[model samples]
Target: MIGVLIFPDFQILDASGPISVFEIAGRYAKSPASIRLIAAEPGPVRSSSGVEMLARKFGSPSAITTLVIAGGDGVEAAARNPCTLSFVRAVAKRGTRVASVCSGTFILAEAGLLDGRRATTHWVRTRQFLATYPAVKLEPDQIFVRDGSIWSSAGITAGIDLALAMVAEDHGEEIVQKTARQLVLYHRRSGGQSQFSSLLELKAPTGRFGPLLTWAREHLGTRLTVADLADRAGMSARHFTRAFVAETGTTPSKAIERLRIEVARSRVQSSSEAIERVAEATGFRDPERMRRAFIRAFGQPPQSLRRSARAG
Candidate 1:
């Protein structure tokens, strides 16, 4: 059985994302592994987003073969708690295969479970992690790191990638591909795949141009010219240019390209659609144009990113 122990104020995806992958793996594996959600307590646990989930609490480590401790804000305080730290130490003593997601590293390191082990956590939390757990060898660049049976992931979304790798380890390549397809996720994102997508969070501009930015996201497929956008917003080109830059950190042309890159990243992960087809659908005139835009934003051609998704 593969067991995950979640704590209070856990990141939602830190639990849900990995489960989505393993649930599919359970169906296709030669010998299905049981997946369980174990919490520190039996009652409802609140997530970072205020979503609540009821979980089975295990005060002691069970006979489960694989154990994962998920991360969140409650982790810092939990790591310091005698009960939580003792529970973690006991689990490690049983030779359980232990792993952590994002900030969950705190609890494991606190219990001395990660001493001299290669691990990772959310990139934004690296400084705190280093300060708290100096014995662990923390690698900031990886999406996930595995040293022997102990595994750790960088952040919430990366947990899914780590879970897929675990599935691959248990069932082999074909089963991992099937699971990825079922979950609509990447097969094996290289541990190096980035945590941030500046394009995905492309913040909408405010003030008079706010509505215009919304209109643009809705109309990315059209041949949108600055003149056309200005006309739609009922502003002169000169005034709109200054205001647009002030509102969004980018210009009109760059924003459209960034939006398109975000769309392309999703398509590459979820579909076997041809690159050229994706380029056209997302408003690129041709593959070359898309290549230029992709390189400027992602530092690699679109195909390279797609290749990383399939790299084991």
Candidate 2:
């Protein structure tokens, strides 16, 4: 049985997304998989979105093949609960495949289930999570990570991706493909894909600089410097540099490089454009420079990523 653990103020999609994947996969499998919603306290549990779900007591059936913990605003409190931590620890000790969605990793960490293990959480919580759990090998850039029996994912929808991977493991690629089709997901994103999209990361700045970042994306083929961006934003170079960093959590050069990489990667993966042309079009005039940037950003060169994309 696949069991999803929920607590008060848990994110609704964190549980439901994975549940849907499992449910759909079960339909196409020879033997259907059983699913259950569980909680420390058995009853109607309110989600962070204000939706309520009926959850069975955690120990009601006493056995589960896989146990997924949902994450949300209440994770800090849930992490502190002795009952919740103990329950997670006990289940993991029994060799059950244990996983956490987004902030739910805090609960597993508190229970000492993720100590010295490679794990990932929502990208937004990367810094705090690293500072809090110094023992965990946190890969904040990954969409999901699996270490031994413990699994973790980046954010809400990533839980669905993690679930699809689990289904693929238990069933097969064909089963997961069918499940993905039913769910209308474009494709099952690989775990190695980045958590941060170039456009999304740049649009993170909510201030006056937000529109400027969008403009930068549109003109990636040209050289973009702090001075150039400052002129566009109508600010002095020094002030623009400080403001850009303050608003975007990144320097102007880094932001430009990210934008270029995004466009370059998209072209590489989706088009038959030559690597040199892609580099020039994305403002990395030097093919070698683009290769290095790709290596830095994705742990692989452009050609390698292109090959992997094609193979997939």
Candidate 3:
């Protein structure tokens, strides 16, 4: 059984988002899986919004195969709660795959389980996280960070992405895609945390443009023209343009441009190559075009981004 622990004043989605994905993945697991919601004094735990969710069970680390901790406004309180913090720390010794969603990283950090581990939390808390927990290697701008058995993610809905990754790790990509299909959510988020920090670009594009946008991402390094996208979708440019805008809430060109920019940004952040080299790798042949695209998309040029991304 994969047990998801809920706490008073925790983020609601952090508990539900990953739980839903785990249910679907469990269906595909060799031994399957069962989900249990454990709380300290299990009755109904109040959420950050004051909504009470009944936790089915009331126990700690020994009762489950995996322990998932959700984060929310209450995390600050939980961090200081000796009982709760002790429970979290005790779970680490149980040979369970421990994972944290969003600000839930704070709970683990407080338990002293995160010391010397490379982890990520919501970008908002990065400064405080560094200042408060100097022993941790905080990479705040990532979707998720895995160090041995510990998994930590960025804020809020990143819990879902992190869960999907966990599902992929446990099962495979086919099961991951299946779980995403069950939720009607396109598997994997585009651009990671960079997309969140920048103008929102790659999301689950809807309507008729969905397939086209997916295809565009699959072929980012190539010359992806509007006509090519239209051809793939079997629509004329005029009709495709209207449908693309309606589906994605952005024009086809804008979407592709954003996608390219995101791809470029990934290169800039992940590689030690020169800015010009990264630009060429992401489909911008010339350094100037890449710079302009970066400025238009992120208000900064590729060179500046390269330096900052590397420094971080």
Measured by TM-score, the strongest candidate is 2
lDDT of 1 by residue, 51-76 (tens): 98778877457667787788988887
What TM-score does each of the candidates earn?
0.63, 0.71, 0.64
Question: In every candidate, how many clashes are there?
Answer: 0, 0, 0
lDDT of 3 at 102: 83
Span of ten consecutive residues with least summed lDDT in model 3: 192-201
Residue 173, candidate 2: Cα error in Å is 1.2
What is the lDDT for 101 in model 3? 89
lDDT of all the models against the reference? 0.75, 0.84, 0.77
Model 3 lDDT per residue over 183-270, tens place: 8876776544544542243555445455667777777778888898889889999888655543433446767777788788887888
Q: Given candidate 3, what's the lDDT at residue 265?
A: 85
| TM-score between candidate 3 and the true structure | 0.64
Superposition error at 115 for model 1 (Å) = 1.6
Residue 30, model 1, lDDT: 54
Model 2 lDDT tens row, 128-225 = 78668879977665678999999998888999989999999999999999999999983456323342533246545346677887888889989898
Error of 1 at 273 (Å): 28
* Residue ranges of candidate 1 with Cα displaced over 4 Å: 30-32, 191-312
Q: What ranking of all candidate models by lDDT puts the best one first?
A: 2, 3, 1
